[model samples]
Target: MCIAYLLMARKNSFLWLLLLSLICTLEYIVYMGAKPAGDFSASAIHIDMLQQVFGSSRASISLVRSYKRSFNGFVAKLTEEEMQQMKGMDGVVSIFPNEKKQLHTRGVLDSGIWPESDSFDDEGFGPPPSKWIGTCQGFSNFTCNNKIIGAKYYRSSGQFRQEDFQSPRDSEGHGTHTASTAAGGLVSMASLMGFGLGTARGGVPSARIAVYKICWSDGCFGADILAAFDDAIADGIQLPLELFHGNEKTDTNISFCCNDGPVLASITNFSPWSLSVAASTIDRDFFTKVQLGDSNVFEGVSINTFELNDMYPLIYGGDARILQQVLVEQI
Candidate 1:
């Protein structure tokens, strides 16, 4: 009887140990399953590290300011000497002709048809031999003459969604032209002819651009412009450290539209800091002649008429005028 009792005791002990082991294994699996997937903390840490290394701290700001002061002083001295020389010379009518620094506010057309080398394979379109379509103003041939610096972001299947806004890339080159006119680094025929050189040199030369490729390939949807504005504002805030140098002033100019219609009401309501500009060809009427022209002639077309087929009338002409008037009043 004693031996049988010992055997039962040992059997019970073994069964208890097995059950505990099973429970521990199940608990571990459940704990692992409940954990989140990707570790965002790691990425955040890297970003912080980058901000520390290459980013401008207060020290960098001081250095930049000192340098700018010295450079400006030198330029001022030279200008003073020039003025003195002119004063001594005869038949010098005046030294200063108002010397007005023209202020230009820029805008973006939220078109969808931006070309990308990566999308070529996805769409079965095949990659172009070279990425650049042409050069505009500054830098070397290889650097400047290529397509827009950040065309990759504008391709189809990018972050832009149709539900958000409907415009894509530039099919009509209107967006590109508008962008170039606003903040393009390159000089075109207009600049060479002294047309848009001074007052038309855009609001900011070195402003960082954040594009929202919401427009369709052919045309733009007003909703897309609104989405672009929202996205741009969000992106600007999220990566403020990455987007602009700490020492440099943030660009307040927001250029959009082509030439001369009323600013988008939604844009004005949302991004008050941004200045919306409509295309202003040398035409007689407000709602007519949306095509880009050089010195009052349609750029590519030989025929000249106030044709609705060629023009982009404001979506709501009355609304556009009201918005334009409001923007004017604000200025």
Candidate 2:
């Protein structure tokens, strides 16, 4: 009998073992497709019949949950062999073990300040799935439409000003820009200032947006990251997790940065589930500048040519040092 169950599990599904408990005597959660009805009395009657098929007691069977007319189904508890038998019953549609689901820690979005427009080959794909809920406040003009299916925010420390930080309404444009890059509607002749003007669109123009504002100007908190991740998974954002590709690897073409502290791989590196995207360059010549006291100026390399060139005093790394050594240093 043990071998029979093992063979059945192996042949049936990868999910079979996932959903079923290892113990032979433990209860299994089965999803049974139910009959349509104005009232659920018919489904209840089937449940009663299903109960009697076993031992007609709570010890034998129990309905964990039942779906309404919209989705005809029920989740029930039964032993492994009984669940197998339940699959063979006259009105039974399908049965499988229910298992716990987890969220991948990281998800990647392709690099860019974002393009004027991104074109994709979506020959076989259908329209985007709308599977999330929004948390936009009614009093605010910030809205969530069909294309933008979800909006959410998380803040573990209630330190920010209530006016600007009260809701998912993005004040800094960080959240707004990222959301647009992922699923923005088609815009004609979009550009940065008078530069790079062209038709702007997202990688999936038809795809819906789900916003999770886990950051503020200060920075994102660890607790907020967890909250955003939980909501993203619950909202059914099933796309692969993305992480940094350590662009500053100490080698050719990679002008390594010793300024940003010791090199450490982002969490996206360790997980096999993530797709680590390495940053690369384009043909467009961009400029970077470091200004000194008086008229002295040094130019560096970068794609961002739009720095304000504000007259705020520029100081060397030595000039910015403080007497207090509070930051933790690795010996």
Cα deviation at 65, candidate 2, in Å, is 25
lDDT at position 162, candidate 2 = 46
What tens-digit string does per-residue lDDT give for candidate 1 at 1-331? 4334444555677555333322222100000011124533422332333234323231122110100100110001112323344344332222332121111222453442333311111222233324223212222211111223332122222344343333334444444444544444423243323333333333443332234444443334332332333344433313232111122355555444333235444232213444555535553322223344332533333333334555343367568888889999999
Candidates' C-alpha lDDT: 0.32, 0.49
Count of clashing pairs, candidate 2:
5
Instruction: Give the poorly placed runs of model 1, Cα more than 4 Å off.
Output: 1-106, 112-169, 186-200, 217-219, 237-331
TM-score of each: 0.27, 0.41
Best by lDDT: 2
